[model samples]
Each structure stands twice: as C-alpha cells, then as structure tokens.
Target: MDGSFENAAGQARARVALRWRRIGFSALVLGSCAALLGLMAATLFVEAPDPVGIAMLLLFALTLPWTTIGFWNAVIGFSLMTFCRDPAGLVAPHLRSIGGTEKIASSTALLICIRNEDTGRLQRNLGWMLEGLVASGESRWFHLYMLSDSNQAPIIEDEQRVAAELSARFGSALSITYRRREESSGFKAGNIRDFCERWGSLHQFAIVLDADSVMTPAAMLRLVRIMQVQPHIGILQTLVTGLPSASPFARIFQFGMRLGMRSYTLGAASWQGDCGPYWGHNAILRIAPFTEHCHLPVLPGKPPLGGHVLSHDQLEAVLMRRAGYEVRVLPEENGSWEENPPSLPEFIRRDLRWCQGNMQYFHFLSLPRLLPVSRCQLGLAIAMYLGAPAWLGLMTLGLLRQMPIRADLGALLFILTMVMSFAPKFATLADVLARSPLRQAYGGTARILVSAFLEMLFSMLIAPISAVAVTLFMLGLPFGREMGWSTQQRDAEGIPFALAARRLWLQTVLGFVFAVCFWRVVPGAVWLWAPFVLGLAGAIPLAMASADPRVGRALAAVGLCRIPEEARLPAEPEYATLFAPCAPLSPTGATE
Candidate 1:
C-alpha cells in the first residue's frame, strides 16, 4: 500500500511537470510568433495600412506560426545538442533506462507496407534487415509481414518471388508472411487495418515500415526493448535519415533534410514529449492500443480529402493519446533510413499527396476529448500546406501593392524571416561544424561547407517550385481534384526535358509574369524577389538539370553533397552493394 501510494505520487508529480513544460513551450512559441507578427504589422502599417497592405500582413501572419515553431525548435535543439550530455535522453528519459542487454520478451511484427514497388530494391532492404535480426538471435521475438497492395501482375509476381527468396534464404530462422489485397480500400491504412484484424493479436508491438524503409537490427532491438520496458508509450518513432543516393536531386534535397531534421525533431521532441509526431513509417507502435483504439475513421466524402484517411499516422497518434497512451519520438539518428524522392517531379507529386491528406485534418480539429497539443498538431499540419498559398499571396500582394517603405527596415525584416525560415538546417549545420567528429563523419570541414552552400542553393530553388505546386494543388482540393494514391517512382532516372517542361509550364509562365511585373512596377527592388522569380522562371530547366543522369554522375564524381553513408562502407557487408553507387570516387576515378 505504501509503495502504491509512492508510485501514485510520482505519477502526479510527473504529470504536473509535463503540464508546465507544455505551458512554457506554448508560451515561448506563441510569444515569438506574436513578436514577429507585431514587427510585420509595424513594417506594413508604417504608413496608414490600406486593404492590400492589411491583406499582406494577414497572409504574412498566417506564415509565422509554422516558421516560428520551427525556428524555436531549432534553437532549443541546437542548445541541447551543444550543451547536454545526452540530448535524446533529456527529452525521453525512458530511453536512458534502456541497457543494450535487455531481453526482447515482447513480440514485434515488422510490417512492410507496399504498393506497386520495385521488388528488387525491396528484397535487398528486407533481406538485410531480416539477416541482421536473425543474427541478433532475436528473430524469434519478431515476425515479418509483407503487406502488399500491388495491382500490377508483374510487380505482384516479383513480390512473390522476392518473398519466396527471402523465406528460402532465412529458412526457419525468421517468420515471414506475405499478404496482398485485391482492393486497397483504405490504401496503406486499410492494409494495416487488415493486418491488425488478422494478426495484430499475435504481436505485442508493430514496427511499421514503408517499402523504401530499412532499419538495422540494433535499431529494431532498441525500439523493442524500449517498448518492452515502457508499456505506457503507444508509439516510438525513430529519426529516419535519408539513405545515400547517387541522384543529385535526392542527394542535395536529403542533405538539407538531414541538417534540418536532426535539430527540428530533437527540439520538437523536447517540448512535445508524449504528444510527439508519428510520421507514418519508420516507427514502432504498441499493437494492442494501436489496434484497439487507433482505427481510422472514414471521412464523409469520396477520394482526396474524404474516404479513408491518407495521413493516418497523426490521427492514429491522437487516438492513441486519447486512449491514455504516450506517443513519442526517439530523436536520435540511429541505423534507420528511407529513400527520398529521386527528382523534382516525384518530389512534387509526393508533396501534393501529403498536402491533400493534410487538408483532410480539418475535419478532425474539433474532435472531442483530444489534448490541446493534439489539436495544435492537427492545426499545424493544415497550416503547413496553407502556408504555401499564404506565401504566394504575400508575394503577389507585395508586387501589386508596391507600398512605399523604408528599405533598411524592410530588408532587415526580410532577412530575419529568411534566417528563421532556415534556422533548423543552420542550427544542425552549426552543430556539425562545431564538432570535429561530426565534421569528419561528413567527410571533413571543406566538403561539409561546400555541400551546405550548394544545398542552400538547391533549397532556395526547390522552395518556390514546391510552394507553387502546393498552392496549385490546394486550389484544386475544393474542386474535387484528387491526388490518387499511386506507385511512386523511386529510381534516379533522368527526367526528360519535355516531361519537365510539360509539368512546370505554369510555374515558368507565372515566373515570367512576376518578373515582368516586378521589373515594370518595382524595377529598383527586383532583386528582392529574384529568388522566387528565378525559381519559377527556371522551374523546367532546373527540374531537368537536377534530374539529369550526367549531373548526378558529375556530383557523385566530385563527392559533393555526400552523406556519411557514402563516405565510408556500411558496417554491415550486406549494404555494400546498395551503397556502391553512392560511394565516393577515388582519385583514379574508381569507387573508393
């Protein structure tokens, strides 16, 4: 009785502490956003604010919360990375209690959800993971389920052959199951649901993986052990980094992503605590709670924004939280990876799908019994896509309004905004450069700096292009324009010039129009909008060049934008073939 009372008291105290952390984090984010918005208001209304100026301020205001939250996350993350002994442990104390020798008593289902995908690549990723797990002697505690929704006969046959090969290779060392659905009713979520209904009872936990996801056995063991020890956690998401890619577009894009994600995730996890994000894949879920309470609701419509939830991860997280379970992210970049889109066109296609799915979150904002943070998360997801249109609106309005302003203050504000916008990447970059080990891991200071500079340029070019695409997609969401769930092109194939031109014609035309208008109306300040204009104007060529095989080869040859995985051989011999194409070239032009 006394021990129970002490335990209850400890829980109470922890709850109070968490509440305070949430309050403090909220105060910081809201306060920072308010201050920035005030500055923008002052800048816009220096003279009496007209309707256009007011509209610009409103749009600018809309863009702030996301940027401010990200900026603060980066700042806090950088501080932790620089100052703390164990930054991830500080955020997730449960992780500190995990000793590597812990027994994996809990049964975990490794669910690899796939659509029509490249089975060869899938086979390699799955085989390595299974081999690692088997070697760890924890194969008995885990099961592999290849849940496929492949409609193509060829791909389906390939998936079967791959599954057969893996089964034959592993023999009885690991349990492997392959299931395919004739109709992908709920898309990926439905596929998962079918698994839950059929075999979820067999496992205590599920580590969800996309077709492109690959996790080392050690990482899988860590997640399993953490879940085994901490039964209260519903979801534990790993910080999945991009795999080394030979594609120039993917390399540069993921390099920027790698820089930003570390700080952003760490900082967000610090405050988000139990209300952390679950990014669909590369995460472990408590099967019981996830199956019992986290079933997705079909929205009241058809396709796109309606029917089955496309962005099912967050909603599942919310539901799990509502069921009184902690949803968390392990912010350390361990041996977990996923392939990014190989080119600009594929990237846009993926981004639009997310945009469409995020827009569906509007229906859940008013959900009952949800924690405030959960609602805020849903709102932020919506705002993420909404900010694209808001940014475009601000630019369009700025061009049209051409309001008289003090150049120095305006420029200062613009600089501040840009700094905050890129703070996550900058924060992680600073951390990387500050540590000698990190610099060496990334192939030294000179290479890191060069890669970062080039990546910055790539980011600037891609941002406006993505924004325009998202804005256009968002505009069509209300009119029944659906980005259907389809097989993603994962290969780093060169995009044809005609294909690029066809896809980005609107962006190019809009860029030309903006340039003409900026020159005619505000020629003196045309440089102010150069980044956005040039990105739009050169959208087609940029897409083609970024996706060009020669460009990728050139970048690879020079060791530019190389990730750590590319600099050295993977610890596991099985990954050698996978990383060979991404490996740095020797002085003699051979792969080092």
Candidate 2:
C-alpha cells in the first residue's frame, strides 16, 4: 500500500512540475513578444503610421514571437547547462552510468537505413562501428541490419556488395543481414515500417542509423542500458554532433551547431519530458510499441501539402506518447555523430526538403488526443521555417517604410536580437575556456575566440541568403511544387558559377536592388546592412569559396574553425584501419 502511494505521489508531482514549466515557458515567450512588438509600435506611432508602416508593424509582430521563442529557448538552455540540473530531474531520473557490459542484456537491432548514399564511406563506417562494439565487448547484445531503399541498379548492387563483404569479414562475430526494397513508397518512414512489419517481433529495441551516422559502441551500449532500466520510455535520442569535416562551410556551420546544440538540446530535453524529440537517425526506439502504436496514417490532403507525412520523426514520438509511452533525449550524452552537407546549395536543398516536411505538420497539429507539448513542437517546427519568410517580409517592409529611422534604436534592437539568438555560443565558448581540457581540445582560448568571431560573421553573411531561399521555397509549396527527395551530397566541391546563379539569381537581384536603393537613399545606413547586402550580392562567389576543400584545408591547418573531434580522433582501432581498401562486391553478393 505504501509503495503504491509513493508511485501515485510521484505521478502527481510530475504533473505539477510539467504544469509549472509550461506556464513559465508560455509566459516568457508571450512577454518577450509583447515587449518587442510594443517597442516597434511605439516607434511607428512616433513616426506617424502610414499603411506601409502599419504593415511593417503587423509583420514585426508576427515575426517577434519566432525570435522570442528562440531567445527563451537559448536562455533557458544556457541556464540548464550552467546550473547542471536536469529539467526532468524531479519527474524522471536519468540512467547515466552502467555497472558492466553484462548489465546491457536486452537484444537490440542496430538498423542502418540507406538510399543512394555513399556506399564506400558507409561500408567503412559500418565496419568501424561493428569493430567498436566488439572492442567494447558488447557485440553479442546487438544485431546488425543494413536496410536499403535504393531504386537505382548500380547503387543497389554496390550496397549489396558492401553488405556481403562486411558479412564475409565479420559474419562469425556478428549477426549481419542485408535487405533491399523495390518499392520505397513512403521514403524513410515507410522503409522503417516495412522492417517493423517483417521483423518487429525479433528484437526488443531498434537503434536507427542514417547512412552517415556513426555512434561509438560504448554510447550504443549505454543507450540500450537506459532503455532496459526505464521500461516506460519508448525512444531515447542522443544529441548527435557533426563529424570532422574538410569543407570550410561544413566546419563553420557544424562548429557553431555543435556548440549551441549541447546547451539548447539540454534545455529542450528537460522541458520535453515524455514528449522528447526523435531526430530520424542516431536514436533508439522501443520496437513493439513503435511497431504497434507508431504506424503513420496518410493525411487527408493532396501532394506537397498533404499525402504521406514527410516529417515523420516528431509525429512518431507524439503517437508513441499517445499510447502511454515516454520519449526522452539526453542532450549532454556524446558519441553520436553524423556528417553535414558540404556546400551552401546542398545545405539549402536539404533545408528545402525539411521545410516542406515541417510545413506539412500544420495538418497534424489539429489531430485529436495529441499532447499539448506535442502540438507545441509541431507549431514550433512550422514557425521555424515560416520565420525566414516573415523576416524577409519584415525587411522589405522596413525598406519601404522610408522614414529616417533612428540608427541608435535600430542598432540597439539589432544587438538585442543578435544577443538573444547567439548568447549560447558565447556561453559555450566561456564554458570551454573555463575548463583546461575543453580549452585544449579546441586549440586553446585564443583559437576558439577567433573561430567564434569568424563563424558569427560568416553565419550573418549567410542569413539573408538562406532567408530568401527558404522564403521562395515555402511560397512555392502551396502551388503544388514538390521537393523531390534525393541522396544528400556530402562532398566539398565548388558549385558551378552558372548553376549557382540560376539557383540564387532571385536572391542576387534582390541584393543588387537593395544595395542600389540603400546606397542612393541611405548611404549612412549602408554599414548597418552591408553584411546582408554584400553576402547576397556575392552569393555565387561566397558559395564557391565556402565549399572549396582547399579553403577548408587551409583553415584547418591554421587551427581555425577547429572542433574537438578534429583535433583528437576517436580512440577506436577502426579509425586506424579506415584507409585500407576493400574489393568491390559483385552482383551475386561476392567480393569481385
């Protein structure tokens, strides 16, 4: 009776904590939006409102919430990381350490799903991952499955050849299997569901990996142990950091992302208790519940806007939670890694697909029996992509408002927004410098500071380009333009000038026009928007230079844009054997 009472009490306390968290988050977001919008409104009133000014005010109001949410997320996340308190501490205790390899007794299927990816790199990484598991003495606890969705004959042959070679090399030590589907109807989600339907009952859990994903065996083992200890949890996602890259753009973008993600995701995890995020890969899912409860239903709509759900990760988590299971994330946990797109165009192309996927969430938000936080996540994803267009519109309106806006107030607001958006980066830098090991890993405090400054400046330069590109893409989604899925390009190669121009001519034209207007009417104001204008005006060149491997190699040699992983490679022996070549796989699954 006492034990049951304690359980009930725990449940009641969790409910209270979640309630307070939601209330606090809501209040912060709403308050920030109101304050910013009020300031803009006051400015407009003093200027005397014309229709353009009023339109600017409305757009600013729409856009302020997006910034507000981001600002608070960073603030809350920074606080959480600094204070070192798990947000879900009172409600759920984290399984941080394990006793021994023997303790991780649950059987898990490590599923690596691929579709027209770099097969050679995939094979090499897979070998290392398997070797790492064996080295960690946890190979017996997991099985390996290479599930392919490639429709191309050459790609399928290559994948099978690689699979066969891997099996030949490690078959005695591991349970490895390869399967390819002819009809990849639903894309990745459909691929996963097909696997579940066939072999869902074989394993208690499944760890999903993308073609580019690489998780250390120790990390994989720890994740499974956490699941073993926590029966009610349906999925646990690790905060994946980008692997070492040779592309300057990849390095710059990934470094900033790695720095911010640790703190931001930590805060996100704490607030998102049972409804934590599931980034399609580098996550472990409870096979049975995910198989039974998380089957995705085709939404009632047409292509692009509806049809099969494109962004299925968050929706799956919501569905899992709806069936009385918990989804959690450990943002501080390391060892999960994935590669980034090598160039600007490739990056935007990936974002274009995600933009479509996220926009589709608008239909799912109204579904019955969904949790409030789940709904909030969907709304946030939508707002994330929508914010780009909103900012674009606001910028256009600001230019059109034509009143001599005070440089002082504009500068102040810019600083405020930049600070809110980037406080975590500075905090992360400070956190790194405060610790000797962290500082050394990043080539000391001096290097980190220089990198941060350069990264921030470069990121600012890219902001307008991304904003304009995404805005155009989002606008076209309504007109039945579908972003066709394709293999992600991960090589660092220069984008052709003509191709770059063709893709980004609209952005370039806008930049030229903005520069012409700003130069003619507001020459003094040019400095304020130079980064934005110059970045767009030189879009083709910037894209080319950023994607140049020569630039990336030069930057790395000088210790600029250095991440910890780059300086100190993983200790796994597989990394050492990576350069050793393997023979190609034949059509009949034999090394030719």
Top candidate by lDDT: 1
Which pairs of residues collide in model 1? Answer: none
| Cα TM-score per model | 0.97, 0.93
Give the backbone clash total of model 2. 0
What are the lDDT scores of the predictions, listed in order?
0.88, 0.79
Where model 1 places Cα greater than 4 Å from the true spot, the runs are 1-8, 570-574, 586-592
Query: Backbone collision count in every prediction?
Result: 0, 0
Residues 1-592 of candidate 2: C-alpha lDDT, one tens digit per residue:
9999998898789878877887888888888888777767666656667788778777776666557766676677767556655543422365553453547778899999898988988987998899888777668878898888888889889998998898888767778888898888777899899989988798999999999898888788878988887788899888888876667898899889866776566556556777888999999999999999999888777879778888889889889998889998876636888888889989898898999988888888898999888888888888888778887787777766667565666677777777877866765776777778888878788999999999999988898999898988888888988786788997677678888888888888889998987787668776678998988888888888888876777677677778776444444334433311111224563322
RMSD of each: 1.6, 5.0
Residues 147-259 of candidate 1: C-alpha lDDT, one tens digit per residue:
99999999999999998999999999888999999988988899999999999999999999999999989999999999988889999999999987767898888889889
Candidate 2: list runs displaced more than 4 Å. Answer: 1-4, 85-92, 97-102, 403-407, 570-592
- State how far residue 244 of model 1 sits from its true place (Å): 0.7
